[model samples]
Target: MLILGGTGDATVLAVRASEIPGVDVITALAGRTRQPTVLSENTRIGGFGGVAGLTNYLREQQIDLLIDATHPFAAQISFNAAAAAATTGILHLMLIRPAWNPTTGDRWIDVESNQAAATVLPGLAQRIFLTIGRQELAPFAHLQAPSLDTRNKSLLASQAIDLWFLIRMIDPPPPDVAIPPGKILLARGPFSLEEERSLLQQYEIGAIVSKNSGGDATYAKIRAARELMIPVVMIQRPSVPSGEQVETLETAVAWIRKQLAIRA
Candidate 1:
């Protein structure tokens, strides 16, 4: 089995799935982070080009099953995995975690893309906490703060008040990457609620921009935002490939076992 993995759920799934007696789990990471947590000795890093490359890999590896447990926002890879699995005549499963929903006290403004999030940000707040991943920061880089002119007609210009981004990611982005004006915090989660609250309070964060990459690992920020009453400019997840997808780790493992049993 080839597991398209990068998210924490993928790691957990790899470990659980490998325990199935006859299953051989090979987890693949995209190598986005400087130092990704090693899943196992069978883990492979880097991309497989695209659909063609991945299809070729599936054929060469003799993989009977392909499981995509990548980040929710990894639309391209998910689509590629689906296409490759179909081309190779292999069973494919998407172990995508469910997206987060707004609850009581949550102030979430849903947007289709990061660019849409950027468009709505100025009206929301000045000091922004950007929980979106490092790779997705380009849209917010040129965000200009609202300015008050003599006539009070807000003008959009780079010279206007600055729009600050508190960019947080597991690893620092490459030197060449263009990020918004802000401080970069390199850390991994599940961050504790206390820590999340402190970080938001410390920065006096007025708004948070986050991808709806659902899971408990980073949900503390959302919870903290709710408590603090800070609005979150939530970027809705991209369209995933149409196929069989299970939301829980248990269900995925069960499906793998069932498939193996049927084959046996």
Candidate 2:
């Protein structure tokens, strides 16, 4: 079985799948992070080029089942996996955690994309906590104070905002990319509510910007925002290729076992 992995659920699924008798599991990581959590003994890192490359890899590996246990926002890989499975005549399943729905006291301003979130920031609070991943930081860079140049004064003046961001990520962003003026917190998630609340209070965060990548590992900040009555600018997940999907890990494991049993 070939499992496309990165998220916490993916890691757990990889470990569980490895224990099943006669099942040889190989997990693939996109290698976006500087240091990713080790999933299994048989793991491949980096991209497979594109759809063509992925289809070739699937054929060469003799993979029986393709389980897309990737991040919800990883639409490209999910789409490629579906296409590749169809081309190679293999079974494909998507194991995704359900998205977080708003409850009472939760203020969520949903947007289609990161660019839209950035565009709407000025109208919200000035002090923002940007929990969106490092790769998506470019859009919010415009919120930074304008550069001092006479020739570009008009453009700069138009783009200028009083907003200050607190960008948090597991790794530092790429060197060449420009970012908004704020402190960067480098840490991994599965954070406690106390820690999340303290961090928000310390930074005096007025609003939060995050992707709707649902799971418990990084959900403390969302709860903290709710408790603090802070509005969240949520960037919605991108559309992926349609397929059989399971919301829980157990269901995914059962589905895999059923497939393997049929083949056996």
Structural similarity to truth (TM-score) of each candidate: 0.94, 0.93
Q: In candidate 2, what are the lDDT values of residues 99-174, reduced to their tens digit?
A: 9888999999999998999888876777899988788788877674443457844536555655799999999999
Please give the RMSD to the true structure for each candidate, in Å: 2.4, 4.6
Candidate 2 pairs with clashing backbones: none
Off by over 4 Å in 2: 144-161
TM-score of 2: 0.93
> Model 1 reaches what TM-score against the true structure?
0.94
Give the deviation of candidate 2 from the true structure as CA RMSD.
4.6
lDDT of each: 0.90, 0.90
Q: Name every residue pair that clashes in candidate 1.
A: none
